[model samples]
Structure formats: structure tokens, C-alpha cells
Target: MAALRKAIQELKQLKEQCVEEQGVEMAALRETNQELQQQKQRCVEEKDKELAALLKENKTLKQEKQRCVEEKDAKTAALQKTNQELKQQKDRCAEEKAVKIAALRERNQELTQLKEHCVKEEAKMAALQTKNQELKQQKSRCVEEKDAEMAALLKENQTLKQEKERCVVEEVKVDKKEDVEVKVEPEVRHDVKMNALEIEQKLLRGNIEELNMKYGKLLKIHEKDKAEMAALRKTNQHLKQLKEPCVEEKDAEMAALQKTNQELKQEKLRFLEVKHFEIVVLHERNHELQQQKERCVEEKDAEIVASHERNQELEQQKERCVEEKDAEIVALHERNQELEQQKERCVEEKDAEIVALHERNQELEQQKERCVEEKDAEIVASHERNQELEQQKERCVEEKDAEIVALHERNQELEQQKERCVEEKDAEIVALHERNQELEQQKERCVEEKDAEIVALHERNLELEQQKERCVEEKDAEIVALHERNQELEQQKERCVEEKDAEIVALHERNQELEQQKERCVEEKDAEIAALLKKQLKKPPKALCVVKEELVEVKVELEVEQEVRVDQPEQTNEPIPTTQRRTTPRWRRVINSFYCIRPNVNDD
Candidate 1:
């Protein structure tokens, strides 16, 4: 009985210790459960914060994308407007160029007509000068003949005076001889001398009449020469008037040509100015476009950086959440290990207590013969209490197992959520990379287009330069041709002046020759009159009259011959046809080449 009591006391002490241990374990389990719940709440809050941040970043990205798109659209519109303006400017320039070209063509045609008129006028002037030269020659010859006749008449008068003096001397001699011969045959000799003297006087009067007629003819010829000189002077005045008008017209045409040239130069300068302005505008536009592109690139880079930063932030948050969850999971695992260890210790304690109870039961059975019934009743009640405590422990273990299963399911769900978040982040990163690639491709395309445009502009500039060079060359050729024409005109004027001077010198020389001829003819006529007077002294008075009439007829014949010579120049001065075949074709070719060149330049 004492042993039973001792065993019962020990059992009571062991039960008390086990109950205290169970209570401590229950407190630890409750604390762990509370800590797990708090950790789960913190994880849920962090997840919520992260989700909110992600949503905000996504919204910001969308807004930035929309803004970028709007900016791009605006830039494109501006570029289109600039292009349209450039096209309009180009069209205006083309129209202006065409107008200028047409005007130049008309000017060229007018110049060509003026050139033709000038050539015709020059040819007419040359013909008129030749005719005037021929007329001058005829007039000079007529004047020469008149001078010779005048000299002859003067010589004849001198011969007649000498003849009268000789006749007076002969009459005195005849008187002296007749006084001496009067005794021989006075009546017959006196009658013969008187009759002979009378006949000689009559012949002298006839010669005087012939000389008067020749003087009258010479006076008439002199009058005609003066009239011819007056006509030649009038013709010269008319030619001078005509030449003055022609010179004035030439000057006007030259001034017009110069004006046209000035206008062309002004137009060229204006065109150059316009081209320069266009180039400057193009450069400005290019600069603006480049600036806009740079700004866009900067914006895109900023957006990309922001996205990268945001992604990094999300990744960091995810890492932090994962770390935190891992820590929580590790803590839960540690708590579970600790709970399992406590449960095993509790089970070991229960097993040791059961073994002790079995030993005690054996000892009690051996000692039961000496024990009382009250002790048995007490032992049965204690055993029932132990069984109830074991049942409660089992219930607690089942509840802990259920809690562990729930925690395991929650951790699995969190893992799935973390995996889904990782997948979503990866997908978003991939999308961002694709968007970046597309943007880069678009930039490349734009750059290529710009390069192509620049190349085209360069080619256009080259073509314009070539056209400008060709135009300069044409202008130079035209200038050279104009200079050559001016030189030719100057040379022609010099030639005409020289010809006029030579004609004047020739006229003076002919006048001198005619004066000499007139002096010689006067001497010869005096000699002939002296011989005729001597012959008449031996011949009949009727024969002397016949000789006088024949001399008059010869003078008339000479005058008629001079008139026939003067009319001969008219037949040689027939109008000649002008040939402009070479100049016409050359001008036509030049115009055709210009037309061809213009179209080719425009095409380029």
C-alpha cells in the first residue's frame, strides 16, 4: 500500500509536469499562429503596394506614349506644310523662268530683225555712195571740158588781137608799096588791094562769131556743171539725213539691246537671290527637322530610361517581396520544426508515463492481495482521467495538422502568384524591347528617306549649276558676237570715209588735167586760126565760111558725146538682190538649240 501511494504521488507529479509542458506548447503554437497571420498581412500589404505602383507606372507609360504619338503627328504635319510651300516656290520660280525665257526669245527675234534692217540699210548706203561717186566722176569730166573750152576761147582772142596788129602793119606797107608802084599800074592794083582787104575783114568777123558761139556753149556747159554740183550737194544732204536717222535708229537699237541685257542680268540676279533664299530656307527647314528629330529621340530615350527604371523598381520590389516571403516561409518552417519537436517530446513524455503506469500496475497487481478496494477505485478514476487527457492531445495534434495544411496551401497560392507576376513582368519586358526595336526601325527608315532627299537635292543643285554654266556660256557667245558686229560696222564706216576722201582727191586731179588740156587746146586753136588766116589770104571767102560752119558742127558733136558718156552710169547701177541665207539658218539653229537646252534643263 505504501508503494502504491508513492507510485500514485509520482504519477501525479508527472501528470502535473506534462500538463505544464502541454500548456507551454499550446502557448507557443498560438504565438506562432499569430506571427504567421501578421506576416501574411504584411505580405499582402506589400503586394498591394507593388500592384498599385505597377498600375501607376503602366498608366504613366500609356500617357507618355500618347504624348509622343501626338508630337510625331504634329511634326509630320509641319514637315508636309514646309514641303508644300517649297513646291509652290519651285512652281513660281519655274513660271518666272519661263516668262523670262519667252521674253528673251522675243528680244532675240527683235534683235535679229533689227540686224537685218541694219544690214539692208548698210547695203543701200554702199550702193548710194557708189552712185554718187560715178556722178562725181561725170561732173568732174564735164567741168574739165568746160575749162578746156574757156582756155581755148581766151587763146583765140589773143591770136585775133595779134592778127589785127599784123593786118594794120600790112596795110601800111601796102600803102607805101602802092605809092611806089602807082606810076606803073595805079588803078588795077588799088582796086585789087581794097577788095582783098574787105574779104579778109569779113573772114575775121566770121571767126569772131564762131568764137562767140563757142563761148556761149562753154557758158552753158558751166551752168550745167553748177546745176550738177547743186544736185550732188542736195543728194549728199539727203544721204546725210538718211544716215543720221539710221545712226539714230542704230543707237536706239543698241540702247534697247543694252536695256534688254540689263534686264536679263537683273532677272538672273533675282533668280540667284531667289535660289539663295530657297537654299537658305531649305537649310533652315533641315535644321529644324534635325532639331525636332533630336528632341524626339531625346524624349524616346527618356521614356525608355523611365521604363527601364520602373521595370527595375518593379523587379526590386518583386525581389524584396520574394525575399520577405521566403523569410516568412523559412520562419514558418522553423516554427513547424519547433512544433514537431515539441509534439515528439510530448509523445515521448506520454510514452514514458504510460510505461511507468504499466510498471506501477504490475507492482499494484502483486500488492493487490494486501491492498484495499478503495485503492482500486482511486486507480480506476486516475486511469480514466489519463485517457481523457490523451484524447485531448490527439485532438490538438489534429488541429495543428489542419493548420499546417492550410498554411501549406496558402504558401502554394503565394508561389503561384509570384510565378504569375514574374511571367507578367517578363512579358512586359519583352513587349518593351519589341517596341524599342520598332522605334529604332522607324528611325532608320526616316534617316534613309532623309538621305535620299539630300541626294536628290544635291543632284538638283548640280543640274542647276550646269544650266547656269551653259547660260553663262551662251551669254558670253552673244556678247562676243555683238562685239564682232560692232567692230565690223566701225570698219565699214572707216572704209566708206576712206572711199569718199579718195573720190574727192580723184576729182581734184581730173580738174587739174582738164585745166592743162584746156591750155594746150587754146594754143593749138590759135595756131590753127593763124594757119587758116594765112590760107584765107590765098583762098576764097566762101571757103572760110565753110570752115567756120564745120568747126561749129564739131563743137556740137563734142557736146553730144559728153552727154552720152554722162548717161552710161545708169545702166551699171541696177538693183542687186540681197542674200541672207547663211545668217538665217544660223539664227534659226541658235534658237532651236536654246529651245532644246531649256527643255533639257527643265527635265533635269
Candidate 2:
């Protein structure tokens, strides 16, 4: 009865301790919640200011649109006055465009003639590029090999670090032992660890020495390459120096030739004049070739500088990659801290678990101390066994954790490699598909006997497309919930602003509709103008048709704008999300006006 009372008293004390801890944690959480609320309020205030700015921008955009409309009306009025003038200009433009096209066609013919000359130059450039590529490849191979070695060293360093840390922790545990004999086992283990670490450090020093030797060799090779490059630069400089005097001498000879040709022109009139002109063209081409040679020299110098920078960058990148791999191991300490924090949080959350854990820990500590004292005389043999088992369990757990982390890293690397492979293959596969499509199109055009095969292939493609669509649908369905959840959360965050801006959003919608209608009306009017201009140049314009077209354009714009204004406001009272806004047609019209009209300018 007395023992039961004592146990009950301990339980009460444990409960009290748990309550106190919970109270402290609750106070901390409340403070954190209050801080978060204040921050959120500040964010809301800032967002309100941003909303006001956006509203101002909206008004400015509206003003710009109105200005654009006014400008369009004025432009239309001026265009009516200048319609006759534009017809004359359009004829002049067409003639100019035709002459330009002919000139371009002649230029293409000239370029084709020049392609034969450039072929030899291109071959020479290819040879130079190949040489550069080979040198780059060699440097890349060296960098890759160095990176591999560095990675190996990094792994070794990490293992050594882990072992060193384990030893330190073991030393800390050993320090807590009361008995000298009990401490003796840990002390011996510590000595063995210290010896192992010293031996490993020695090995590391030897590896470092070997790496230094290799690095020295590499440096020597780099110096030799640098000397070769310097020699090449000197040779290029010498060539340039030689070419300058030769070019001057050629110019002198060409001037002398021109004097002779001019004298010959008196005897052989038109024929000599044409020959002289041909000679001048050849000289110009010679000058251009000389300029190209200079450009090539400058480009080669740039490439050499780039290669040097690239080599340095590669070395730095390799070092960073190795260091990053080593840095990953540092996260193990962070993970341990996170686990401790998680445990504290779990204890804070679950009073029963914390209380039970406290009870068990206290009971175990008491029993262990009491048992050690009581058992020492009775069964001193058990001490070493218990200590060994505990050490072995700890080591096993640590090894397993290390193995898991290593495996996870390996798995990630494999996944990344697989994704890269897939990406590379996808490009090739797409090219192959395009080639097949081209073949099919060619077959269809040629009325081939393999029509049956093509039909079968087409059917198969359709089936595959259907299957792809099904797969896409399934994937979309899976992804939609996740997207919807995210959107909902975002909407909830912005709901405060959204409610206040509902009227503004509705106004925006109406304005957007009006803008769309205005753009369409403008586009139709421009297209009508282009057509009218085309007609006026081709045939005399009918006054009745022109008047009807202008009236129709004005009425259409007015009706569309009025309809949009009436309908948009009623339906758009609820705030529409930015993401859900439809893409307006004005962008398409602008693109069409710029990109499409020019191509068809001479098509008619």
C-alpha cells in the first residue's frame, strides 16, 4: 500500500512537470502567432498600397486607350483625304518593292557564285576549328580525370571526418564513466581510433603529395601549351605583317594596271571599259577577303582567350563540385539537430508521451545505477558484455544510416543521368518523327504504291495520338487537384484585397471588352484600307462602295463597343482572377499588321 502511494506520487510529479513544459511551449507559440499576425497585417497594408497603384495604372491605360481611339479617328479622317495620294504612293511602293526584290534576287545569284570561292576558306576554317576542338577535348579529359580524383579524395576526407567525430563523441561518453576499469575499455578503443586516424592522415598526406606531383606535371604541360600558343600568335602576327606590305604592293600594281587599262580604253573602247570594271570588282573582293582574314585573326585571338578562361573556369567548377559533395556530409549534423528539434516538438505536443518518456527514463536511470552497484559483486562478468552490446548496436545504427545516405545520393545521381538521357533521346526521336512525316507527305504527293502502308501508318499514328491524349488526361487529372489546392490557398490569401477590388475588376473587364472591340474595329478598318488601296491601284475605285465600307466600319465599331459595355459589367461583378483572364486579340492584330502585310504586299 505504501509503495503504491509512492508510485502515485511520482506519477503526479511527472504530470506536473509535463504541464509546466506545455505551459511554457504554449506561451512561446502564442508569441510566435502574434508576431506572424502582425507581419501578415503589415503585408496586407503593403498589398493594399500596391492595389491602389495597380488601379492608377489601370486608369492610365484607359486614358492611353482613349487617346489611341482619338488618334485612330484622326488618322482615318486624314487617310480619307490622302486616299488618292496613297494610291499613287502604293504604286510607287510596289514598283520600289519589285525593284528591291529583283536586286535581292541578283544578290542571291552573286552569293551563289561566291559560294565556290568561300568553300576553300570554309574548309580552312573547319580545319582550324577541328584543331581547337581537339585541344579543348584534351583539356576537358584532364579536367574530368582531376575531378574524379578530387571526388575520391573528398569521399575519403568525409569518412575520416565521420570517424574523427565518432571518436570525439565516444571520448565524451567515456569521460562520463565513474569507474576507472569501465573507463579503461573506452580509453583503449579511443587509442585504437586515434592510431587509425593518424595512419589515415598519413595516407591522406601521401595522396596530397601525389596530387601535387600530378598538378605540377599538368602545370608544366599547360606552360608548354602556352608556349605553343604564343608561337602560333607570333606566327599570325608575322603573317599579318607580311600580308600588309604584300597588300600595299598589290594596290600599287592594281593602280598601274588601271592606268594601262585607261590607256587601252582609248584603243579598245567598250570592251576595255567592261574589263576595267570587272578588274575593280575583283579588287573589291580581294579587299573584302583581306578584311575577312583580319576578322579571322581577331576571332582566333578571342577564341584563345576564351579557351584560357574556360580552362580556369573548369578547374574552379571541378573544385566546387568536389567541395559541394563534401558539404552534403555537413548536413548530417544539421539533420541531427533537426531530429532533436522534432523530438522536442513532439514532446511539447504530446503530454502523455513526454510524461511516459520521463517516467521510463528516470526509472531506467535509477535501475541501471542501482543494478550496477548491486550486480558488481554478484555478476561482474556482465559489465563487458553489456558495454559491448551497447557499443555494437550504436555502431550498427550509424553504419546503416551512413549506407542509406550513400545509397540515396547514388539513386539521385542515377535519376539525374536518366533524365538527361531521356532529354537527349527526345530530341533525336522528334527529328526522326519529323523525317517520317516528311516521307509520308512525299508519298502522298507522289501517288506511291506504298499508299496502303502509309494509310496503316496514319492509322497507327492516330491510335498513338489517342493513347497519348488519354495519358495526358490522366496526368492532368492527377495534377489538377494539386494545382487547385495551391490556387485555393493563394485565393484565400488575396481574398481580403479581392473583395475590395471587385468593382474595379468589373470595370476592368468592361474596359477590356471595349478595348478588344476597338482593336477588332481598327484591324478591319486597316484591312479595308489595304484592300481599297490594292483595288485603286488595280482598277478605279467605286465611290458608292467606298462610302458604304466607311459607314459599315463606323457602325460596327459603335455597336460592338456599346454591346460590350452593356454586357460586361453585369456578368463581371465578381472579381475575376488574373490567371483566368482571357488573352485579348489586340496582340494578334499588331503581330498580323507588322508580320503578315509585308509578305503579301507584292503577292497580288
Candidate 3:
């Protein structure tokens, strides 16, 4: 019994030690689970922060894309407006060129007709001069013939006077001889001499009247020829005065035409230069747009790759958390099995002890019956020995009674010990039941916590999925928008290319027109220069003096026109600065300088 008690005490101590050990293991498992939960919570927080940062970055990128799109749209709009304005300017230039060409053609025709008319007038003037010369020679010849006839008449008159003197002297001598003969012959001879003298005096008087009439007629014819020559000289002067003004007006018209041609040529060249500049600007803009597109695409690809990597990391974390949870659940299941096995062994040991105690109680009852029978036999013998052995028998009975009392006391102690042991077993069973209830509660709590954690993990997974879906949707939307923008850009590029081609064609046409204009201007300038030289050569001194003043005025006008052309470039909204203009090609600069200098020289 002592050994059994010792064994039972040892078993109780072992059970207490196992219970303490299980409690410590449960504490350690709880601590580890709490730490795992804390770590998972921290991981979730970090993932959330990363997701938030990624979202913020994505939003910023989208906003930048929108801003870029708006800026591109504004630039495209501005380019379109500029293109329209340029097209309008080109149209206006074309109209102006056409109008100028028509005016030039009309002016050329007028100049040609004027030249023909001038030629005819000059021929007519030459013919009239020749006719005037013929008239003057015929008048001189008439005067010479009249002078010779007058000389002949004067000589004859002198001879007639001498003959008249001789006749008078002969008449006096005849009168003296007749007077002497009359005295002798009587009255008939004196009457015949008187009749002959009277007839001679009447014939001399008629000849004197004819000579006076002839001298008066010759003086009247000389006065009439002098008056006719003076009238012809006046008419020739009037015709020359009338032709001078017409020739001067023709020359002025030619000069104006030449100036207009030069202006047109300059304008064409300016337009061509402006077109080339616009083309260069457009090409630069296109290149910049392409570079911007490439940069945007690269940035988007980088962002997508980063997001994908982040998602992969999150998935790995979730897998690690699940693995940890599975390991914890497996450990908990193993701990429950160990606790159940210990409880079963304790119950089996208690049953074996109860069977051994029952067998010992049956053997003690048989020994007590045999001891009662021997005591009865000993009482019989003491009676047989009678009174002489009474004292010794009495003493022996007392000893037996003492032994029975000791055995009862011992039985009472054994019963007390068994009662104590049963009480201890009941207490231990109650403690085990309490421990099992605690463990069950703990397991239920652990299961509930696990369920809650699972719920939280499921909710987190759903949230992550939703976030991924939203990110994908946003990315898809962005891609669609970028595709649309790319298409618009492509269309814009094609349109710009077409516009450039059109502009190039137009420029080529304008260049051809400018070349033709230049040729025409050169021709017109040559014609004007020839006309000026001819006028200088052919004009009378008084006409040349008038022309020099008019030429100076024309040159001044040409200079003013050239200055206006130079000022025209300044009228542009963004004119090239003087420094930039000075950097122009040498040939262009030389051409401009020549034009400017020529007019000044002509003015001088």
C-alpha cells in the first residue's frame, strides 16, 4: 500500500508537470500567432501605402497627359490659323499680280501706239519743212527775173533821152532855114511846118504814162512775197510747240510703268522668302511633336511595368501569409492530439489502481474470518484449565483484544487513505475537466480569430482586386485616349504635309511668275533707258532742259517707291530685326543695295 501511495503521488506530480508544460506551449503558440498577426497587419499597411502612392502617381501622370494634349491642341489650332492667314495672303498677292499685269499690258499698248504716232508726226514735219524751202526758192527766182527786166528798161530810157535831144536841135536849125525860105516863098510853106511839130509832142506824153504804171506793179509784187514768207515761219513754230507736250507725256507714262514693274518683282521675291520660312518652322514643330510622343510612350511603359511588379510582390506576400496560417493551424491540431493522448493515459492508470485496491480488500476480509475462529478455540482451552490458569488466560484475552483494536485502527487508516485517494482523483478529474474546457474555449477563440482573419483577408483581396480592375480600366482608357490623339496627330501630319506640298507648288508658280516679271522689268527698264537716251539726243536744247527736271522728279518718285517697299517688311507682326536682316545672303543684300542705290544715283 505504501509503494502504491508513493506511485500515485508520483503520477499526480507528473500530471501537474504535463499540465504546466502544455500551458507554456499554449502561451508560446499564442505569442507567435499574435506576432504573425501583427506582422501581417504591418504588411497590409505597407501594401496600402504603396497602392496609394501608385495611385497618386498614376493620377499625376494622367493629369500631365491631359495638359500635354491641351497644349498640343492649342499649338495645332494656332498653326491652322496661321496657315489660313498665309493662304489668304497668297490669294491677295495673286489678285494683285493679275491686276498689275493687266495694267502693265495696257500701258505697253498705249506706249506702242504713242511711239507710232510720234514717228508719223516726225515724218510729216520733215515733209512740211521741205515744202517751205521750195516755196522760198521760187519766190527768190521771181525777184531776180523782175530785177533783170527793170535794168533793161532803164538802159533803153537813157538812149531814148539822147535821141530826143538831137531831134530838138535839128528842129531849131530847120526852123531858121525854113523862116528864110518862107519869107521868100510866102504863106503856104509856114502852115505845113506847124502841123508836123504838134503830132510829135502828143506821142511822147503817152509813152511816159505807160512807164509809171509798170514801176508801180513791180513794187506791189515784192511787198506781197515778203508778207507770205513771214506767215509760213509762224505756222512752222506753232506745229513744233504742239508736238512737244505729247512726247513729254509719253515719256512720263513709260517711267511710271517701269517703276510698277520693279515693285511687283520685289513683292514676289518677298512672298517666296516668307513661304520658305514658314515651311522650316512647320518642320521643326513636327519634329518636336514626334519627340514628345515618344517620351510619353516610354513613360507610360515604365509606369505599367512598375505597377505589374508591385502587383506581383503583393501576390507573393499574400501567399506567404497563407502559408504561415496553414503552418499555425497544423501546429494547433498537433498540440490538441498530444493533450488528448495524455488525458487518456491518466484515466487508464486510475482504473488499474482501482482494480488492485478491490483485490486487496477481498484478501483482508478472509484473514479476519480465520483469526475470529482461532480466538474461539483458545477460549475453550482456557475454560478446561479452570481457575488455576485464569490469570494467564485473562492476560492472553487482553492481548487479543489489543490486537483486534490495532487491526480496526489500521483498517480505519486504510479506509481514510482510500477516501483521500478517491478525493484526489475526483479533484484531478475536475481539474482536467476545467483544463479541457479552457483548452476548448481557447481553440474556439483561435478558430473564431482565424475566421475573422480570413474574412479580413478575403475583404482585402476583394479590395485589391477592385483596385487592380480600376487601374486596368484607367490604363485602358488612357491607352484609348492616346490612340485617338495619335490618330489625330497622324491626320494633322498628313494635312500639314499636303499643305506644305501645296505651298511648295504655289511657291514654284510664284517663282516662275517672279522670273517672268523680272525679265519684263529688265526689258521695260532697258526700253525706258533707251527712250531717255534718245530724248536726250533728239530733243532741242529748250526741250532737253525741261526733260532733265522731269527726270529728276521721276527718280525721286522711284526712290520713294523703293523706300515704301523696304518699309513694307516692317509692317509684319514679327518683323526680322535689322541684325537678322543684315545676315541675309550676300547676293540678296547686294540686289537690295543696288536697287536702293540706283534710284538715288538717278535722282542725283
Query: lDDT values of the candidates?
Result: 0.61, 0.57, 0.59
In model 3, state the lDDT of residue 197.
Answer: 51
Per-residue lDDT of 28-57 in model 3, one digit per residue for the tens? 979978997896677568657756865775
Best by lDDT: 1
Clashing residue pairs in candidate 2 are none
Q: What does the lDDT read for residue 512 in candidate 1?
A: 66
Point out where model 1 deviates above 4 Å: 1-67, 119-123, 126-134, 153-285, 297-604
Model 2 off-target regions past 4 Å? 1-129, 140-159, 171-195, 223-227, 251-255, 258-604
Between prediction 2 and prediction 3, the one with superior lDDT is 3
- Compute the lDDT of residue 386 as modeled in candidate 2: 36
Q: Score every model by TM-score.
A: 0.35, 0.20, 0.32
lDDT digits (tens) for residues 15-58 of candidate 2:
99999999999999899768756865665675576567657756
RMSD of each: 79.7, 64.4, 77.3
